[model samples]
Target: MIADLFPHAQPGAGLIGGVMIGLAAAIMLLGLGRIAGVSGLAARATGIAGSGAPHGIAIAFILGLPLGACIVASVTDWKPATYSAPLMLVAAGLIVGFGTRLGSGCTSGHGVCGLSRLSWRSVVATGLFMASGFATVAVMRIAGAL
Candidate 1:
């Protein structure tokens, strides 16, 4: 279905994206002494949480996410996957927001930045993250939602 929708799918795009994410995380860590976690950064930007970096920086980082995506989409003939309903999208966002808070960090922080530093907490968190994601997909598949 996806390939039918976007025949120009380039598998190398994932590798490129991963490398770009790693580099961005590295830069944030080394330059600002901060973890490049979207959830934490967004929270700080929205004044929901406190962090070492200034709110302005957090806001910039948050804004950059969509800006970067737009730039990529413009350059590459990449099309985003569409979903069925807006309400379901909002519900999914709320669930992800809750999960990020409950987990104490998002995937970028734990899976990418934390694991890179060899943190035990990050390892466990990443494992749980993957497992939960797999379980969610399995459940969704069984429910004929995927």
Candidate 2:
């Protein structure tokens, strides 16, 4: 039904991805008592930040991201997108990293964990993130940059 409504969309993929993400988040929280925020994990892994989960666990989790994706892609026959602009991609990643630090947490931490726990800060941060994203897309679209 969703496929019929949106011919180019892969509805099942999103449902599956969301379920996997939720399951991973649940496991991280329940088993490790840690918030599944990639930025925080990266920071911890790189010794840029401290507290919460151990550095080793953070490093393992960071490494597991691509490994897990590879496993999923292998099992599902899914292909990830290839970015044409490597430099732009790297710049974007750095900007996002800085934003996450300024915001106190990334989407995974704030949107999933913090919001789930009804944190006001997460609520505001997530709202700003979404709004900023929307605005950026709109500006890019208007400038024919996308």
The lDDT of each candidate is 0.88, 0.88
The best candidate by TM-score is: 2
Query: How do the predictions measure up, each by TM-score?
Result: 0.87, 0.90
Give stretches of model 1 more than 4 Å off.
1-11
**Model 2 alpha-carbon drift over 4 Å, by segment:** none
Residue-level lDDT tens digits of model 1 in 22-81: 999989988988899988888889998865469988999999999998998899878888
List the RMSD of every prediction in angstroms.
Answer: 3.8, 1.6
The Cα error of candidate 1 at residue 146, in Å, is: 2.0
Clashes found in each candidate (C-alpha, N, C closer than 3 A): 0, 0
